[model samples]
Target: MASREFKDHYREQRIFVNRTIAAVLVVFMMICVLAARYYYLQVVQHDVFSTLSDRNRMQLQPITPTRGLIYDRNGVLLADNQPTFSLTIVKERVSDMEETLTSLSDLIEITPEDLASFEKRLYQRRRSYESVTLKTRLTEDEIARIAVNRHLLSGVEVEAELIRYYPQGEDFAHMLGYVGRISEQELKNVDPANYSGTQYYGKLGVEGHYEELLHGKAGFQTVETDVRGRVLRVLEKVAPAPGADISLHIDTELQKVAVQALGERKGAVVAIDPSTGGILALVSTPSFDPNLFVTGIDTASYQALQSSPAIPLFNRALRGQYPPGSTIKPFIGLAGLDTEKVNTGTTVWDPGYYQLKGDDRKYRDWKRQGHGWVDLKAAIAESCDVYFYDLGYRMGVDPMFDYMYRFGFGQLTAYDIDNAREGILPSKEWKRGMKGLPWFPGDSINMSIGQGFMLTTPLQLATGAAVLANRGKWVAPRLIRTINEVEVTDVPSPEDVKVNQEWYWDYIIKAMEEVMHGRHGTARGSARGAEYRMAGKTGTAQVIGIKQGERYDADAIAEEYRDHGLYIGFAPVNNPRIALAVVVENGGGGSSAAAPVARKVFDAYLVGSTQLQAAN
Candidate 1:
């Protein structure tokens, strides 16, 4: 309908004005809503949004500190760090792990062991977004291949890191130990924050004993990154503190000489500096290269080491327990003299065999016809079994056990070395506990001869010899000479083995001298042409027991069943400088097999010390 009147036209104009006002109001409300939303985002949650945005472009990375240097006493490097490249993978960045691994294999030679080790680390508890090492010690060609195929590999990165290297190789394998990748069990015990950037840890020997001082503190750096997660620029940085430098008391030249002396023999040698109680040389023959273990030994090589009959990986010097045999005669003689069970003039008549009061079992002596009318000195020098048999029978087991215990037998030496075994020192109570058997007279006799139910480690033997050399002073053996130019002086000292007569030590020392220089001495042949006077004792440990009426036939028995030869000695009787113990597995005689080895060690240490003193 058309409103022709003036009032109707005015109403239409009013209606048009109202419609315009409504449209304007609607526009103004929408503007207000938009302004409120902007204010909420920019002001209310501004800090939270800003932080999230920055996180996408910035990252915190851990910096591994340099592992400390290891050196011999003379500054020869033992353990070192070498720059090497490794292939790493970030799980979060990879879409398909298996597919990515397969693709990466084409670019680099990825072994099955690498994949297995990577998969093992993948399931282990680790930080999110952290990269995992897939293959370590990457070659230059492999690194170039990966760099060329960078676009094809999304989660992969070629990272450079320091790897552990052993310069001395097998020479210090057991003593220096070797570092390897952090084990799952070790990771559980280590501090997560401190070990975040660290990979390897000490597995054995001194390296294991000083792991804390060797593994340095970890540092961190804040860096700017692009959308692709590549570092753009450094924002802030914190430098890590390097590990403390360690210096061992080991002499490299002496170690070489000892190894050379033990050539072609399956045995162990341990030499110590008597004055400072520092370990000079520790050699276990048929040693394997520790470098192989550091970079992860291959399955075949590791299996070969584990399965070999020679057992090259065994740390015989620290862990092997052998029957002490006749090498214990000097200590037993001292025990006899100290206890007054026998005096210097006391004598025993031997007829090649000994018998207990009523027992018909005749214990045969090593000599078919024994040394007649032997005194304490002659018994020790001649290695007369019958003389000790009578003395041991008279002293019984308790006194012998007490005396041997004072000499550090049957218990851990408590030395600075790791994994030092406490060899068996049989006692009445021990027998009851171990074998559920009562103490017998035959057991005492056997023990006095250092046979049957009694055992000792080469370290224990050497330490015992050092105690004798020190004239009853108990100085614990140590490996670390100093740390970072500061001498290590907190070594524990055991109480002295006080004797009723101090001169008894001199008497025993004089008798030991005879074992090397005397015309009738057991080891006199090996001690020939020596420029310096030395005190020594030789031992033959029986491997197989003969029947009551049968004689030992080495030719009839297997080589493994042959007797183990042992020798213990200290140099320059007037002023002792070195004490040593040598054990040759399946070697026939102590004088022929083990004593010759000691002669070489003595020559090396004594002569070398003189030369060193002259040079200084």
Candidate 2:
């Protein structure tokens, strides 16, 4: 109202026109900016957004390969596979982990142990979107229950998987071993990609040795999944390759015989085919059922095995380190002949005991009143310790250690034998290093008798006997005969023992034969009425050391403190076929306790062969 008096009509018209032009220009710029943004989002970043959208529905899943089958030489199925259903959960698909587990418990029996194990693996290293097992071996009723409540539960599914099953149960557990849940420590070592969907792997024995060959390649499938993580339909599929089937050198017939021979006693027995250097039988008594360990063993059960007085978990054939006792006499005899320390005519007078020149300690023999005049042959045949005691004292510890090491003692016997122990072969240097003491002549005497620090496994003794049977030709022992029906005898070239005289082999072998056939032979009772000739040696090792003058009375001491009986033998002395080593824990004597087991094994294997040849 105040400016009305000075009104300029032309100027106002110009101002109105300028304002309309500026408004139109601003509207045009805003429309261009919006159009450019729309184009960039739709055309340039199209694939990126499409992938994010597809991720909500599509998923990649891993397929576990079929594990290999295990068999004995006679085509007996040792390890098998059975279909099983397990409760599994994918954490990413779940909303509340605690709530889901609680709800699942209402649907099925979720044991405290199950919840604990699931919680433990919740944070373990795993592939993206991989399912964690909550419980295994779901029953049919549980499956039905889960299906009925599927709509309410998220990230839960019943997965069908193949579980390891043992057809022979406990008979071949230690040899074949069992698969178990992947431990957290083991997970750190294995390739995560290779074990994508796999839960169990070999934990011991042959299974562990051949894990790569047994666990086949993993495959994958791209599939459409629902919001709850249930597979709707497969978009793409890649089938996994099955593992190779393997056949071991073990004979089911011979293995059974070995187990039966041991009876209820806790012992170990190993039998080898001298010709092929094949392991025919391996037996460890008080064996546990392998199936119990395949899928995670419970804490209580595991603790029981770990705490048992018998130590059933231990693999004695490959790992038990015990004194060879008098069974080493034959090998000592061979060492003596090879070293020129003693010959066939070399004889030592035994007046019940042996004595070092300056020492008053009496190293007594099995016979209180020993053989009056004992040569190398009589020494071996009668298991005379006094005669060898003098020979070993003269030969010294290092010399015997070298010879014994060559026979696979104090060293792993075979390349493929998993965890085969290298038993102790005591020497002057060993005594100083291990015990911080100088070697003495009495120490040599004890070493000669396979006592003191000298130790050997049953497998080593059997391997040694096989070498003797082969007449110094060494063939590295093998467990597997074939893989996928193809020969897998990947044995290294053996170093055949070349002695000073080839006749030395025959002389020692002949002396061993007398131990089974001669009237005064230590193992004569066990070899009575044998159709074919055989060579053998007996051994008895003390569990508790006897004092300098104390005589061992088995009746007075506890049974657990009794001597461990041992024997090494082979059948058909001239054309040796089967060589074996037997160890009977807490057994009174080798001749009575261990030799009989070897005899039965020999009769079963050799007699069957004889009958088969006659029939053919």
Q: Pick the candidate with the highest TM-score.
A: 2
Worst 10 residues of 2 by lDDT: 607-616
* C-alpha lDDT score of every prediction, in listed order: 0.88, 0.88
Candidate 2 lands at a TM-score of 0.94
Task: Point out where model 2 deviates above 4 Å.
Answer: 1-36, 608-616
Model 1, 464-531: lDDT tens digits are 89999999898788889888979998888778788899999999888889999999998998889988
Model 1 global lDDT (CA atoms, 0 to 1): 0.88
Clashes of each: 0, 0
For model 1, state the Cα shift of residue 58 in Å. 1.5
Model 1 ranges with Cα > 4 A deviation:
1-41, 608-616
